[model samples]
Target: MDPTGTVAIRARLAQAAAVIVTITMLAGTADLALTDVFVGGEGGHAVYRIPSIIRTTSGRLLAFAEARGSQSDNGSNDVVVRSSDDAGTTWGAMRTVCDEPGRSLNNPCAVNLTSGPHAGRILLMFQSYPTGKGEGSVATGFDGPYTCRTLVMHSDDRGETWSTPRDVSRQVKRPAPVTSVATGPGIGIQLVSGSHAGRVVMPFNEGPAGKWRVYAAYSDDGGDEWKLGEPAPEDNAGHGNEVQMAERADGSLLLVARQFGGGGRRKSAVSTDGGASWSTLQAVPDLVDPSCMGGLIATSSVGAPCLVCTGPASAKDRTNGQAWISTDGGATWPRALPIYPGSFAYSVPVVLSDSRVGILFERDSTSKISFITLELPSNAAPAAKTP
Candidate 1:
């Protein structure tokens, strides 16, 4: 659609009094409605950061973030979430899904099982650390007060209630020498095709903070038993950290990651064996990175295979939040649209029921976690097959 047509859609929605806060309309993109789902210093938390969003099987939108007691990364933090039944038009009360008295429960990565006995269950995985220990101070072991541990929880009732967290550090994290692990800080993906169909793949990063390496922790029996996968081949471009994954229509997986202190360009890899191994990493020429995590989602809108990415468009700062559309199965991003003009970081995107895309992101220097939805222009043809 044209720019004028996009504006008309916004005008009609406003006339009908939709329960949304219309932010701004960019050229050639549909109404970009904004909703502040989590506010800083509210609900007894000092700040909110690291937004991860997903739509459940029951069609409920669950937005998750770390509710920190202080602005520091090592401050007392809890994994909290809020749900919206109307596609983010309105949100329910905030609830804490994981917490500890003197520990930090961070990185809320979630995925929904679609088959087997535990089908429809939502699995949430996060990392736990001592209250005063950040990535640099965390030890390189599988068990200790200073070591990082991976935990998993589930909610069978769609964000209303959750089960007790189960420790899976042994299954997911490697021992001594690989420390300071993070589970996505974004959402996970489930394969819909290929020999390993219905597999759950969650992006992960390990090793010291600056020397970080990316891998995948996966489950085959609908999240029944978790196991670690081989790490991606090291690239001379940069060290990978805080990653996200999306499966292509041809069944291969594409992993995008934030480069830890390299040039301002995102790194990517491909996996043909269902996340067990990956090809050598390469720098994404189009995505401008600021050493911050970004969001990614794959969709087949109108039968065209495409990928939507959300991140800071500027190479120097975390400002100028924007969304880029990749119709060629993530080979390149030729189209871009603005999401926020300033102070945006750590975002995740989900495909709404109406074929529109919803991005939940942190803005205003971690004071607010907001959401926005936009319609993708349907112009590209279906993706060609790859071997």
Candidate 2:
């Protein structure tokens, strides 16, 4: 389907007076639309950064971000979220998930449990640090006056309300010799394959700033207990931190990370043992990223296994944001389509059980965050086998 059709669909939805929220059931629905759930600066914060969106099992869409006092990563930041029930046509007011007295709650990585003891439960993981410290206190060992600690919160009734945060820093972070850890800043995954089926996994990275490496914080007994996995082995293959993950059709997890150090290509790695360990890292030379956070979701959208990744498509600049589809797992991402053509920043993708895809991302204007839904064209032939 030509993306040009999106404009017509939006007009139709507006004509019908039906508000589009989240990712609508667009294929058969009479109308389709796109809207921003969070309008940044207007939400009492100077800017909203870091978008992490997910459609709960109950069908509610929760869009989370950091309400920043300034565009910079540090300062008076709070983890806030807006929810939608009618897809994207309407949204609830912004609610603070967690805010510390003098600390910042940054980088929200969340997952809705579909299986296990916490089935239907929504768990959120983030990092917290004193506002004044920022990453400046990032010592190679533990939270040095400013290095952040990992914390978690959950919602039982969709996203209407949340519970108090439980400090899980010990479970996901290490002391001394390891510093500056961050959880996702995007979406996590629930494995439905192999021996580790039903495991909850969150991708995180920590170490010194320039040498940060990725790791997984996963739980087998639902979200009650999370354990840190070995540091991402392929992480050294890339130059930056801030990672995102999706579960492959075969049950393994695929990680696509932003490449730093001149940013010619993205970095990638795979985990076969439910994120407990990772395979060697490699450079995804085809998916060029300009050192920006991206999104990924593995779903049988085309009637066969497919992995869709979203981020700015430019390596030298942050324009021409697009989604790259991989048919042969994560080996090669050849299919690319534009999501936003101008001033695109961080983005996150969620694939519903029915194969509908919803992307929430940051745009260049005042409204800041925008969402769009799309259907992956069906193809019986498997993604052309790649080497």
lDDT, candidate 1, equals: 0.82
Best of the candidates, lDDT? 1
The window of 10 residues in a row where model 1 has the poorest summed lDDT is 1-10
TM-score of 1: 0.91
- Tell me how far the alpha carbon of residue 386 in candidate 2 is from the true structure, in angstroms, after superposition: 20
Model 1: colliding residue pairs: none
Q: Please provide, for model 2 over 92-131, each residue's C-alpha lDDT reduced to its tens digit, 9 standing for 90 to 100.
A: 7889888887787788998989999889999999988777
Q: Which runs of model 2 end up more than 4 angstroms from their true locations? A: 1-32, 140-145, 234-240, 353-355, 365-367, 379-387
* C-alpha lDDT of all candidate models, in order: 0.82, 0.76
lDDT of 1 at 5: 23
Tell me how far the alpha carbon of residue 345 in candidate 1 is from the true structure, in angstroms, after superposition. Answer: 0.5
lDDT score of residue 32 within candidate 2: 28
List, in order, the clash count of every candidate structure.
0, 11
